[model samples]
Target: MSGDTALVGCDFSSAPSKRKSIVLAFGRLVQDRVVLDRLERLPTLQQFGDWLAAPGPWIGGFDFPFGLPRELVEELGWPTDWLACIRHYCAMPRDEIRARFAAFCDARPAGQKFAHRAFDRLAGSSPSMKWVNPPVAWMLHAALPLVLEAGVDIPGLHAGDPSRVALEAYPGLLARELIGRRSYKNDDRAKHTPERLIARKDIVTALEAGTSRLGLRLKLSHAQRDALAEDASGDALDAVLCLVQAGWAAREGPPRWGLPEALDPLEGWIVSA
Candidate 1:
């Protein structure tokens, strides 16, 4: 990994619009610390792809699942090769995909409604194939193809632009480390209250203080810090959380772009999960 690679984090929405969409945060890592410099709103995935094409020598932690559950992939008879499986998945109609997944879950017993990737259990994330609630199933359906087509390398998954390595990031992992289930932000205005703002503050304070096991602190102008906390939707903060993971992967993650050597290629691991 290059020492000067830029770091990025994104919070994705499956059906992005100006009202609720993807949020992109990017910055540079210096001296074992990260400084978030910009936040961008991509109202659509096409625009996100356009932004990704701008240029690189960057490592980004995307808040989306990169691969499906190996069990699900096998049961569905999808290709097992990382890139092949993703291409096959991205080619399906959303409705058909939903129907298939629903059928898979319906046949299983309760609590087993979803198939989990190894890293989903490890990261405490919703199953990548889950269509509702967090809707990460749709997120994967919506995002991974773009990541693959962006020509960026996704370690343990696909080979593309070596300088632009994309890693699966879960901000909840970092948030859980900081707040222990204290709710931070919500899309509903009613849910965005003082308590949530304070949780965001505490999470930011700890990041700036280098209190986490990653030992990486954040460098920010007061304005930048405030901006991260003030977004009631938590998208900005989540992006920053992913930024921390990206920084760690660049600095301390395995030589394979912060992924484990023996990682399940068809079920990419989450960075810092």
Candidate 2:
């Protein structure tokens, strides 16, 4: 890892379209600080994959699960090897995958319907195998292949094109540190209000001042900050949150793509968890 490597934060959508889709935050870490360069939104997964495959030595914090629960994988008789397991899981049709996950949930007690990857609990993120709510199960199915196809290295999970190191990241983990229990954004137009806007401003301000627990300041143009604040979907801000973690990880220069040495391969760890 080099200090000057570009960092990317991906806020992903498995099935994206023109109205609302995936967003990326591009940045560069200089000294002890990170500069949020710009935001890129892609209308389709193909476009996102193309961007991922585009050449560069970069470190990325992508908002998606890299693996499923170990217990789930074992019980399902899936491959134990990280790359093989994900590749097999991604091969199934969406409906069959949903049925299997739903059956697993139906067999479990309420409040324990989902089998979570270790990183999910560690980062307070949605369960990787969840088929509803956030539907990360489909996300894993939809996005992992693109990452794999792009040849980006996923630390303990998958070895690919080492020039691009990708790590699991959840923006909520960083967001909660600065504004606990405060919802900063909503896709629903009816829910967008002054309070949420204020929350976004507060987050941006804390990041710019280096007062957040992440210990890295973010520099952005006034218009850039304003654009992030005004977006009701919060995708741009979420990408920046991932960028912060990526920048911190890049500065550390961990050999395993910023992941801890003891991370379980069956249930990959989240970056900055």
Candidate 3:
């Protein structure tokens, strides 16, 4: 990892809007501290794609599944090659995707409906094939094309511009480690409460103290810390969580981006999982 390279952590929405846009935390790693530099919002997919293509000596951690489960792909008879698989999956309409995935689930027994990536259990992530709740499959649908179109390298999965790297990230993984399954955010204003606010503060304090296993402190100005804690939706804070993960990856240096060397190329691994 180059010390001077920019680092980004993104909280992505498949269909971005003014109310829930894609959020990016721009920062850099300085020794053991990941500094919070700024935040940017893209309210449309095109702008998000353009941001991905922006010339970079930068690496980013994006909140979306980069691949489907191998079992799901094989069952659907989609292309098994990573890029080919993504292109095949992306070419489908949303309804078709839902129908097909629904059928896959219907064939399985209760409690074993969604096929999962190997890393899903370790990372405590929803199955990438799941279309509701988190709708990570839809997230994959919306974001992978933009990433592919931007021609950025995806470490274990694909090679593109060497200067720009994108890695799979889940803020929940780090949040769980620090806060222990506590709900720190919600999109619904009615659900936002004092408890969630305290959870956010706890997360920020832990990150600043380098309390998590990643061993990297978060450097934030007073304003930045308040901004991260006070955002009830958690989008900004989630993006910064990813920034911390990206910073950890930068420190680890790559070819693997801190992922295991034996990762299945067709099913991407999350950073620091």
Candidate 4:
């Protein structure tokens, strides 16, 4: 493995996720080429935090909301301090949180029931504003603190530790680029049909060959390749996708892919940072 690796992809699960706590993949860039190195499955947030604090040359592309819009935070009177705000958010009971958000939405104009950041429209839907996505609310609840603790600056989102850098990413951005609305992963056993397995293989091939439009590639050992292929469901594969994004971020540098300097502190960036 490259000792001074660059990017990592995290397939983030919101709180109470049935998925693994965190799936991290490592990568490096050589002569402008992106290579995947390692993929690790962390079973808890503590383990993930420990990894972040460990000594190594790395930048991470985590799949979580790095910030809420300043407008929303101010409107709700949430704490301005990132860590304090997240702690208060995590401590709130789900019902109360939901009710408050609902009230906030209800008070908005009829045409705009849910509050949206500028990027929300580009990203399809905002998980922060939805409930069915499950523990994502909690993901936002749990993750922001770690980002703050890591001290990675997120432009408008955070004032982070200078040593550890973090960028927001979504695997969907890359996946959609490859498959274009075709379903690639399913926890449902019924949905893990042979066709999906073939799709997984093709996706893997594209990643390994560095043919995807994301301008990235994956490096995997024979064992890792077999492991991904043998899994009947695509949970592991999806995690690998997150890993690829992570690898990209690590290699591409902090808040990788040219994240804007003046992003809305509350409204987070997607893959760029």
TM-score of each: 0.96, 0.97, 0.99, 0.81
- Model 1, 1-273: lDDT tens per residue? 566678998888889998987998888888878988888889998998887776788889999889899999999999998888888898999899999998999899998888888877777898998888888978998887777667888887777787788889999999989889899999999888999999999999999999988889988889988898999999989999998899998887445766777789889899976
Q: Candidate 4 on 27-69: residue-level lDDT in tens? A: 6666535566676778777777677767555556676776665
- Compare candidates 2 and 3 on lDDT and give the better one: 3
Encode model 2's per-residue lDDT on 210-241: one tens digit a residue: 87766799999999999999998898899999
RMSD of each: 1.3, 1.2, 0.6, 3.4
lDDT top scorer: 3
Q: Write the per-residue lDDT of candidate 3 for residues 1-273, one digit (tens) a residue.
A: 777799999999999999999999999999999998999999999999998988998989999999999999999999999999999999999999999999999999999999999999999999999999989999999999999999999999999998998999999999999999899999999999999999999999999999999999999999999999999999999999999999989888877779998899999999999
lDDT of each: 0.87, 0.87, 0.95, 0.65
Give me the displacement of residue 136 in model 1, in angstroms. Answer: 0.8
User: Which is superior by lDDT, 1 or 3?
Assistant: 3
Residue 212 error for model 1, in Å?
1.0
lDDT at 67 for candidate 4?
A: 60
Given candidate 2, what's the lDDT at residue 60?
A: 93
Q: Give every collision pair in model 3.
A: none
Clashing residue pairs, backbone N/CA/C < 3 A, model 1? none
Residue 90, model 3, lDDT? 97
Which clashing pairs does model 2 show? none
